[model samples]
Target chain A: EIADAAEALLGAGGVKVGGALRGRHVLVTSGPTHEPIDPVRYIANRSSGKQGHAIAAAAAAAGARVTLVSGPVNLPDPAGIAVHHVETARDMLAAVEAALPADAAVFAAAVADWRVAAEAGQKLKKDGNALAPLALTENPDILAGIARRAEGRPRLVVGFAAETQNVVAHAQAKLARKGCDWIVANDVSRDGGHQSGIPGGVMGADSNAVHLVSAAGVEHWPTASKAEIAQRLVARIAVALGPQESQS
Target chain B: EIADAAEALLGAGGVKVGGALRGRHVLVTSGPTHEPIDPVRYIANRSSGKQGHAIAAAAAAAGARVTLVSGPVNLPDPAGIAVHHVETARDMLAAVEAALPADAAVFAAAVADWRVAAEAGQKLKKDGNALAPLALTENPDILAGIARRAEGRPRLVVGFAAETQNVVAHAQAKLARKGCDWIVANDVSRDGGHQSGIPGGVMGADSNAVHLVSAAGVEHWPTASKAEIAQRLVARIAVALGPQESQS
Candidate 1:
């Protein structure tokens, strides 16, 4: 019945109101990727997958078929969404590749930027003074990877800019670098009320503030709850996917 | 004694390590602003204030005397930071104005884009099929306000972009619209995995992934906790705020 309704909506679409994203496929990445430094010591970030989990749930609620390629996190799978779990950034990228031909892709996972070039099977003991420096290398940028895809690329590829100072300037540069459809720029500076502690913890102790930057222009939204922000953002997406008549 | 050491470090040109921001003044805004629909119903967003609050704490830790102007939300104030509370977007703007004349400003608050033109003191009754249409007006862009300030303007002004689609394109436009030094862009769409159902909470979350965009180029960071992101951002700010740096 839902499929039939979606087909009907798509067949005669003048201005879709009830179901804007009935046939869209959305790809999202979540949680933290672990980069192994040694047997015990690994590079990772603090992410509990709360934000990513909530985003998947919200997308499902908005009638989108979501494929959430997640990193290692202990959050229950959101109902009505397909889940693909991975551990490292490379695995997450592969999972994203498997879920290709999506209508939209959201690179939300906190991937490790660098990984130890050599992984010691055994944990290294602390040296007295002359400790060997661990050589590192850059990791693949999943957002850029998807954004720069030549085949089966999603129509909309989004990136995130977690900055401290000159937030807008950084976001502008990222827009060009990643070639994504949009960038959600945020100041993660400890002094700006962002996450400043360990990962894999809870979040949203206070309210939030954000700006929406797009080709149309920059629209600033005042402070509110993350849930409220999601609803407003979903509504905006609905409009963006709406027919020409509905836009005006 | 610490002040004298700081002066000595400045004199010796060795303060650039971690104490580069020793005496800078920073103004930050966080949380959601409410737009009253009635006494009971108001327009708002889902923001936990985690990101903003974290930024404030990080900036303070980085040696900046920070002033946090926030909208209504439940969260303990960070140590060594001055906080001002407000309710509506208008009030937040006023608070920001009152706390001005700082070296830098970060508009991280998720302000409402529109507000009811006039508040109806009494809640309207839902009697029948007929309902009153709400009339909304655009709110002021607080970041833009500070960026365009003529007198006692902050040397650096940063804004945020929370987008779902066309992220980079939108961020670039926002850079122009807000006239800010930088914009931090992120994708917070439902499938972006950065939204939580909880109204306003921020803690115990895992890693975060973000990009740093600037005139020079985009630098993408792998996912980590909000704290790590804050630390890196503060370090970047120290470099940006250093002497005779090229303006991007």
Candidate 2:
């Protein structure tokens, strides 16, 4: 059913499955975390969870046990996946931690780096007086925390870098900083329009042009539908993990 | 078709239209204005635009020529209404100004009071250094700008106050401060849950318990579906504006 839905969404002939990740556990995070300033307002990123959700769907299609931790998104829960819906960065981190001990983990969520230091208990009133600057506090870095873990770490930890400039350089730096095995970098700038010519850039766009950066080298993948990108990435993950005993 | 869709969403037997507003012009603003932090990040309110859209649909059903200037919302354009889509408060204000000289205007949009003073051209990097406090500048008060206008003011200007505390008092103050004729106040606090046993608070919820605050007095309305509330409010608007030759 999940494969069928993915195929339908990504057009026909999408989501090829060979049971490459059979008997393996894969964890995925997607969408933008909302850092609340008050009851009604929050700071958010532009992630639509298309890539991450597609990745999860692909993993599931490959016969992997997939646990998807998602932030608030408009997309429906993909069939045949253990999905956990979360709101804030802290919540997302907790959810990710709870779903750990996977063969691979993908951090595609556009998590907010800073949240309002002091979230108001009530809705903040905008009186005639000049409004005060919202104090800032750093949120828990899920990718760094998980990747740097000494125990029960995923064999392959893939982080995403949605950059506006120096795409590969940023991804390389992010790979080192976050201690992740691979970084999927995508330029989300207005000028970085995908080959499909979809408007509004890659954050929420269907098609993506991504560079898979690892310790060995960077592989610049052509712009393709998010579902196709997911399939390719999952195939690479399967290759990196080698043939599992269950698959054999 | 507009009436049918509204009825379907609001459930069957909804949308009571008496054609009281026939030959009249009704302007409405809906949804939450997104203040950009950068290309990929933004500040947003939790408004679902359900109420405002319902009001617009109700007005259209009442045989009024309706203009809806809306911000970012996950809703289809209501049939039989001239819909103008916008993003930020500035854009919404501009759209509202362009759609002027109406018999009644409903300002239901949760416009951001402030925006980043200096929006970054690129995505702000989260280097190891301590982040700088975001500077915010006041946004143009759309309701006040139109309500207090010396020329071309809508005959009846209605402002909506989504408050967590002092709902009626805040609305009363807002009515005088903005020079709007009426204020529709809704308590959006976590504790101020609607009479309907539905889960989340009013911002994105289906049911609403609203207060109609005018110079005459306050009318506390029972918790009802947003569509029903819209119908009731439109009916009152038609009454307030008096009967027209077309209606007669």
**Candidate 1 chain B lDDT trough over 10 residues, lowest sum:** B197-206
The Cα error of candidate 2 at residue B98, in Å, is: 0.3
Supply fnat for every model shown. Answer: 0.00, 0.67
Residues B1-248 of candidate 2 have per-residue lDDT tens digits of: 32233343344454555577899999999999999988788999889999999999999998899999988898999998999999899999999989888999999999998898888878888885337777888899999999999999999999999888899999999999999999999988777865453223787788899999999889888799999899878877877787776544
Q: Which stretches in model 1 have alpha-carbon errors above 4 Å?
A: A1-248, B1-18, B128-130, B194-207, B243-248
TM-score for each of the candidates: 0.45, 0.92
Local distance difference test scores for all models: 0.64, 0.86
DockQ of each: 0.01, 0.56
Model 2 residue B149 lDDT? Answer: 96
Which candidate has the highest TM-score of all? 2
Assess candidate 2 and give its TM-score to the true structure.
0.92
What's model 1's lDDT at A37?
Answer: 44
Interface RMSD after interface superposition, each candidate: 24.6, 2.1
